[model samples]
Target: MQVRDATATKSVRQGWTGRTRVALVVALVALLTASMPASGVYADQSGGDNNSGQNALNAQQRAVLYNIARDTWKFYSADVDPNTHLPLDNIGPNGKRGTYTSAANVGVYLWAVVAAHDLGLISREGARAEIAFTLIEVAKLARDHGFLHQWYDTTSGHVIRNPGDIDCATETTPTFDNCYFISNVDNGWYASGLIVVRSAMPELRGLVNTLLNPMDFGLFYDSRPQTACNVNPAVTGNQPTGQMFGGYYVGLPVEQGSNWQHYYHNGALYSDPRISAYIGMGLHQMPGDVWWRSWRTLPPKQCPTDPDFSWQGQWPVGGYWQVYKDPQSGKRFNVWEGHYTYPGSDLTFIPTFAGGMFEALMANLVVPETTWGTKSFGLADRRAAQVQVKYTTEQLKYPVWGMSPSSTPDDTGGYGGYGVEGLRFPYFGSGADASHPNLGLSQCHGCATEDVVTPHASFIALDVLPQRAYTNIQALRRLYPDLYRPDGGFYDAVNPTTGGVGHRDLVLDQSMIMAALDNALNQRKLQRHFAADPASAAAHRYLSFEKLSIADTGNGDNSGGDSTGNNNG
Candidate 1:
């Protein structure tokens, strides 16, 4: 197995003969694709809107997706903390045990377990026991107002706050004392998994509800953007730019003696953390217009020039201004459906903070964003996947296409923030003001020798770009025979050039693969589970009734006439 040692900082294991590589590629292709017919849905690429595209995956394709989920579930089924019953964050061929876990990992593990049963990998009783045990132990874990802390020791179910075992993005002091942050994004995933569990296994809804009842997504929401973030209504006529603050810092307030909420906000509406905001709005804990408050690419009026706008973004996007009226409040909001044009191409898309797959597509796992928001997020979701493919194959010329944040392709258990950085533009927002021009790890155009392929990323895009995703998965396994493990579908990450593999199975990644497969094969079982909830119904109109600038929906602003702003159409 070959791996990338970026910067030549460390030696990556490499031992592959040219002849051996050719033989493996030839042999593996036959085994994986031998059954598929050369003709039909596999060849056409129109985003799968036809009978052969999204309508149906051939029996062979369905079997392969199901089997992959079955294999991926094996990781979750076995990697349990005996005392806590919570899944470990990650494990290698025999990666050390008693490792730490996060709220996202624990939640995704629950989804994996339920999905395994839904796919018949486990019996109903077996799945119920697994989820019940994990929930019971989860009740014992420490929390702030029902939102789980970012990290917890798996074995003892203890909060790993002070000097937390993992890197704290908000690390402030040398002691890592500011490590205790309750993540809105992590809990969003946790709550998403709980919705799946409760909906799929009604017998256990009581236990799931006990844990969910106390959770108030509203605690993290701000109804007044003017009051919370000091945005003036004078500059922008407003319904209210009420937003969801990113997450909470447990300690470390502005004042030394008293406790105050220390928070960060996810300005990008497409980020994975939006999952928490979705859940909150679905349950009516948060206002529906908060949905409009998030920027499609930051409002054109205030972007780039506004002092409050984040310069660390793919700003100056092309889009249209539209208004969405909240039925609950009868207030109309001005919104920007801004999208980035793929450099040197006519296509436009909505890019995430890091231009990663899960960051853009993961929330779609439980919530059917593409199905309801067909004109808005759905179109963007398709563009998101397509641009990734075009950049990886057409531009970067990599043999495969799954670029996302995954383990660095080595045995060190290091993490890599890989993505189709050049999907549009290289990150230019690294400049302090405008002159210093620092290139942070934002976007990169044609940056080769540093790309990574994650199999879960392909699965994440399965709903949007099925055929390409399927083809890419086969390409990965064929080109690198070692990429697929015995019980796991594929290793976490791989270097396309060397076929180097990252052999760790992250619970979050594996669970994503399971949820994707479950959706593809079982007619969106998890999505149906979420849709069955009355709460999801409350959030339905917000998704279904809007027209984004990305495509023609015929009747623009479908939520009645635009009462507030000029139709920028």
Candidate 2:
């Protein structure tokens, strides 16, 4: 059986054969006719009632948002794991359905269920059945150290081997030792799902407890192998010591005596940063000091060669405390780095250019980020998102503005690995910036030169930028209706240069589109539920010590202290 590589693109599938393309074209025609409105006339594209001092979604905006939720809920309802009812990773890329389960996808689905229910899109019985089935299946998962496998076969509910690749095991294939390995962020999403379930369905307390208890968050710290580097702290190695910085190893080997080598460790505090912190603070998985220590122990490095590299942590991001000055323009902007890696040497640390369009927004899905205190990454992240939207629209000229570190169609027919990218203008190479004039990756000179617009990148911004989000959604409905799939969600990405779209419909992305819109429209129900929950409340209480320090240090002023300047829209 053929399984799509789960780790390839956030929402891309393998290349389709000629035969499949013909079939897909036929299916696409039928899908468009059935799903889209015949006239394609949106009710109202005008940004609604700005004079009222409240920039709410217009009528057309609301309809598309509702459709996004309905289409995604319909897919989850129809295409989920038969036994567990969790969303399958992929569906109908080449008319082939996915058979494996994704924990992060399930987490997104759980939130979608809540969103759908709140929006009156699904019946109570339907939502209850979906939630109940998911919990039951999750409870029965073949776990190692109380964590679910990254991928699971739908039929047998058995772990799939190397799910990130084509070597993923089928239901009939025998499971291997590494198949039981844990994905920390994925499990964090699972825990997030359970917490949301418990928040919504109080009667399911017993069932939720059974499902949540086995998640041994404590194992992340205690399970490290006591090697020489660990035992002798004086050894001064790259690996972390004393505390577990972030999520545990990628996959824990099933062998009772498996060493740390078998486990894929992400000891850095910022490795996928938010999920571990979310679950850690929200679930009381570890003590406050442990969490604080993990962050404190984070390694710091700087790049002196590249002036664009700027300070160790600072970037020309729009809305953060740590902002950088564009060496040429002498302007402060809030562009956060995608990563801070020490590739060449210990002292030669280089920070990647930019972050995902929705990386920081993902944490906002559950946490009421604006209320989570100013010192945290919340405000800075939002500002960074605003910067991205502005850059994509003004600089890149995407019909709608949104871009992220996602997959893209390569000049070589196949797709490129994920990178900080977006849709490119036709004349992508005529010195768009004063610095790094010939910016690109691979043979396609325009590859890294321009930004790509995505649906969720716009949808997730609804709360922060309501009128902009509404305008973008309406534009999507009017101009790029082709992106609106029959499944009720937009495709993951689109390249403006080639006019190519992603193949797969990612549950995480779709779920975000739906849930984020719901939060923006309906009093932020999801974030309120997550923030007000006891686990998170306790986590916040314990972290008071660190948060206080954060509050003490403001993001700085325009005199080179603050990222959110008066000029920032």
Q: Which candidate is the best by lDDT?
A: 1
TM-score versus the correct structure, for each prediction: 0.79, 0.67
Q: What is the C-alpha lDDT of each candidate?
A: 0.66, 0.50
RMSD of each: 13.4, 13.9
Q: On a 0 to 100 scale, what is the lDDT of residue 54 in model 2?
A: 49
Candidate 1 root-mean-square deviation in Å: 13.4
lDDT of 1 by residue, 12-42 (tens): 1135443453344345334433543331111
Which one wins on TM-score?
1
User: Which pairs, if any, clash in model 1?
Assistant: 2-500
lDDT of 1: 0.66
What candidate 2 gets wrong by more than 4 Å, as runs, is 1-54, 58-60, 164-180, 222-236, 242-272, 290-354, 405-451, 538-569
Residue by residue across 109-154, what tens digits does model 2's lDDT show? 8888777777776655446655665666676767666677667777
**What TM-score does model 1 achieve against the real structure?**
0.79
Error of 2 at 539 (Å): 5.0
